[model samples]
Structure formats: C-alpha cells, structure tokens
Target: MDPTEVNVPDVKDMNIDNITQNTILINSQCESERVKYLFERLVTHLHDFARETRLSTQEWKAALDFLVTVGQISSDDRHEFILLSDILGLSLLVDAIDHPKPPSSTEGSVLGPFHSHKAEVVPSGSDISSDPKGRPCLVLCTIKDPSGAPIEGVKIDIWETDSSGHYDVQYAEHDRPDGRCVMTSDEEGRFWFNAIVPVSYPIPHDGPVGKLLKLLKRHPWRPAHMHFMFEKEGWDHLITALYIHPDPYLTSDAVFGVKDSLIESLGSVSAEQAKAYGVREGTALISRDFVLVSDDETQRLRDSNALAAMADLFPGKKIKLLDHLPVPDLD
Candidate 1:
C-alpha cells in the first residue's frame, strides 16, 4: 500500500491539507529499512510533540522557514547551520556518541565555525601571536603517553579567540592570525609558544542564526578557551579545547565544549620563572599537559568501525560529520 495514500480519509469527500499529505508521501518513498524506521519514529514523535504543545499553525510554519534558511546559508567555508545545530545542542549529542574517549583522555568539544586553512608552520619558542593584541602569555605544553612517557615529535596546531574574544575570521581584514599558531613538539614531546591569554567571546550574532538566538532569548557567548589539534606516530590524533580558568562562561559554553579535565589553572609566575619564560612578573602562564593514547591494531579497527557507523547515520552530504574534520594521516 502507498504509505502516503494510506493516510487518506476513508470517505471520498474528506479533505486534508497538502502539506500533511506531502510529508506522508516522502515517508513512503523512504523504503530502506533504516530510513523507513527513522521516518516512522520521527513522525510519531513530531506528532506527539505538536499535540503536547498545542502547536499553532504560525509557529510550525516559522520553524520550517527557519530550517530552510539555515540550509540555504551553509556553504564550503561557512557553516552557519552547523553553528545553529551546535547552539541547539545537536552537535554536542553527536560528539558524545562518536567520541567516548577513554577515561585517561580528556573529553573533546565543538570545532567551531571559525577554524581556517593554512596556519603558517613554525618552530617551538617562536611566538604564536601573529597579532599582538591578545594578553601576553607563554603556553608550555607536554604531550605524553598514558604512562607519562613523552611521545616525540608531535605536531600541535593551536588557536584561540583573541584577548578581545574575537577570532581573526570575525574581522574581514585583521591582516594577521590572531591567537592561532602551528608548532611542533621536540624530541622529548615538549612544546611551548608565546601568546596572550584568550578571552571568552560570543559566537557570531549578525546572521540569521543570531536573529534566532535573540528570538529565543539565549546568550551567544562561549567561554575563553584554546583550541588544540595534536598528532604523533603510533597514536590516535587529538582535537580538543582547553577552557580558561575562571572564565564566566566556562560552565555555560554556548557550544558545550567544556570538559572538567580540560580546565587548567593559568598559573601566576614568580619573577625568576617569568625571566626564564621571557614574561614579566605577575604575568599569567598557562601550563598544561596532554596525554594521547597509543593505538594498537585492535584500537585502529574499532576506530574504523565507528567511522563507518557515523558515515551511515549522517551520510556524506549531510552535516559534514567527520569527513571534513581534519585528522593527521600518519602512514
């Protein structure tokens, strides 16, 4: 039986809206087992939700229009719709399911909309401060195995919102990479770069997504944080964020990227330590260490399976998922 036609009223004289009939028609076309099951569940839940809320015709139409615009605004470099998904918590839910990292490894967060291409590769001790406006800081980091032994020669790509809490992409012609750097760890798996402390900033609010946030009365701010992408041989790559100590939005990050283990105290340095690190007394230095897991054949197989399952659910063309998300390919 045609699923769409099945919903037609028994009497020939009965009348129903075209929209409702079209929804049923689309569901009928989704005959694959997975798609069929998903459609049935979604339709049931949506119907129940509308009944429970006594949804008005205007409210439903506005929601559909908003989604249509969201898709329309998404593109190769910009993903305003993904940001909308993030702020609405769907992104976090997907991350949680995909990356249940081992207890020893820190939890991950959203790869926000502003991550860009072509961070200039540089050596350790060179300043990560491509622009001089953020708070002056020296970040000292160590990459180690779970057993506390260093993993040699890991590449760390780091970026963060500037001192003013705005990324370079926020401004059209910043002419410099603010709070972003590409550095490699040494033979001992230790790396350090000079930069300024990052401030918490709001997500972009000048677009359709922003208008929706204002309509919903939600704040657009994310906590002050540093974004890190690390990779080394014989180990799984890491893409994670570190939250600033005492940032007001730490607990309520708009993207829900804050993880307890990822928080580090931006330590106050003594005069002597300041001199050694080339910073002034009373300057804040962020000292943190990351532990990456070594992957055996078993772990590699598990990761592959998880990636396959993710592709099945999200497909290649929908939501970008992990396909476009960069990871180091160590062959």
Candidate 2:
C-alpha cells in the first residue's frame, strides 16, 4: 500500500486536451471495476460537454454554486436533489431502466419529494382526508399478481394533495399527517379508503430547481394524481400513481412521470353505493386493479436484456447503453 508503488499515471501540467484522459487514468486505479467504468464515462461526458459548449469559467462556477445551494436547502423533510432529478426527467429515466415490467403490469413513476414515512397505518374504508374543503372520494383498489391472482397482505402507502392542491406537509403548521395513510390489502387483494379527490398542483417551486424551471420557460404544474406504493415479500416493490383523466397538465407533467396506462377516470357513485364504501353521497370513485410483478419475473426480465425490452415499453425512442471507452495510453 505504499504511495510510491501506486500505478496511477502522472497528471502534471494537465490542459484541456489531456485533462480528461489523465482524470480517467487516475480513476482506472479504483478497486471496483464498476466504479471505474462509471467514472470513466462520466469524466468523458462531463469534459466533452464543457468543450462542446465552450463553457466559461463563470458558468462552471455558477453551476457548482447552484448545486451547493440545492444541498444546503435540502433537509429531512425536503429533497431538493430529487426535485432537480425529477425536473430533468432523470428520475423517470432511472425508474424505467431499473424497474422494467411487462405490458400488463403497472408502470412506475416518480416518488416525489413530498413522500412522508410517518404516515399512520389505517384500516380499510377509513377517511384520510383532513381538509373539509376537499371533495370526498372513495378509492377502491385491488392488488394482484401478473397472472391475475389476488395477493393478500400487501402493504400499500397512499398519499395525495387535498382539493386546494397542497399536501399536508406543505402547510406551514404541518402538525399532523393528513391526505396520506398506509393500509393492508385484504384477502381478496382489495383495499378501499376514503380520500379527497386529488387536484392538479404545482410542485414546490420556491427553490433552486424552481428557478431552473423558470429559466427553461416551463410550467411547474403536475397533473391531478394519487400516489401509491405497494410492498410484499415476494413481489417487486411498486411505486406508481394514478393520474386523473382530462387533467390540464396530464400531457405535460413537469416531472414527465405520466404514462398512458396510468391515466384513469373518476366514476360517479350513488348515495347508497357511497355509503357502502363509507363515504357520503355524490362521492367520486376510483376503482383500479394493480398488477404487481414478482421478484423472480422482474429478475428474469432484467437478466434477459432490459435495455432491449425497454424498446417495447417506450415506442419510437432509441435507447443506448454507454459503451466502454478505451483507456487512454499515457505512455
């Protein structure tokens, strides 16, 4: 482990032309091959971007400053980096890459910065809404495997914004949890709960990511949707949301998290039917069946060249994995 015995090439007098090569050479000495491969491409792309754009020193400094601010403002309750990733569509891309599912299975979406782990576990047909202004809605969901068999004992976490388009956490007082809860699927794979009909809302737009969005001339609104996270021992953990159809921002969600299959319409419920679901009259109903992929099936698909399978999921798009770059000859 002597420093003199280290095999990294000399990086002295690095200029624009040789700086990337020398950096990659140093990174190649990493003990982990995966880390080495990742940094090599990362360094190559980062340097290429600087060179291609002729990025000025001031611009580089500003970018670093922006990242610093993003970190400084993030806390236990808020995640600015995830917001940045979502805004840049990286979150959706990563989800698509790692959680590839069959056509029949539900697709994944962004787990936004507002997710709270402190949600209370509630029984079926319980109302999670705390805001009186929000319209009452009954969400009747069924969980099943890809083969259409009911999967019991699935832990499902659900959350959404109230009628005013703001989560409970977004409020200044934010003392108690509302509009979010955790429930277990019954033996029939059914779990119904009373919640407010979610309305379209803008993401937290008072931070650096919001500034970037403004700079890019983009709106910060997301479509009306309810978030759902499903977990079971044998099934793949699913993170998805059901978007309300005819939403203004459905086609142009700021986070690019919407998929055609996830769009659903709210059904009208009769007074008796609403009462049966434990909600008041004129309550809207969202009845949807979620199909989860098993871990074995997910692994099989992942091992069978997920990049190739992604083509079917994302039609009319070319997906490419980064090819390993040849190490530079420093000799």
lDDT of each: 0.73, 0.87
- For candidate 2, the per-residue lDDT at 90 reads 93
Q: Pick out the ten consecutive residues of candidate 1 with the lowest summed lDDT.
A: 319-328
List candidate 1 stretches off by more than 4 Å: 1-57, 72-77, 295-331
Q: What TM-score does structure 2 among the candidates reach?
A: 0.90
Off by over 4 Å in 2: 306-331
lDDT of 2: 0.87
Q: For model 1, how big is the CA root-mean-square deviation?
A: 8.1
What does candidate 1's lDDT look like per residue over 1-331, in tens digits? 7766765333333233343344545575554544554565577668768868888999999989988887787664468988998888888777665555676765667778777665778888777765566667778889887788888888788887767777776766666665677887877888888878888888888777889889889889988888898876777667788888898898888778888888887887789878887778887788888888765632654466556765675465232223423222223
Instruction: For residues 1-331, write the lDDT of model 2, one tens digit per residue.
Output: 8979988787799898999999999998897655676798899999999999999999999999999999998887789999999999999997876777888799999999999998999999888998899988888889998788999999999999988898887787888899999999999999998888889999988999989999999999999999999999988889999999989999999999999999999997777876677566667889899999998887667655556564666665554443322222223
Which candidate comes out best when scored by TM-score?
2
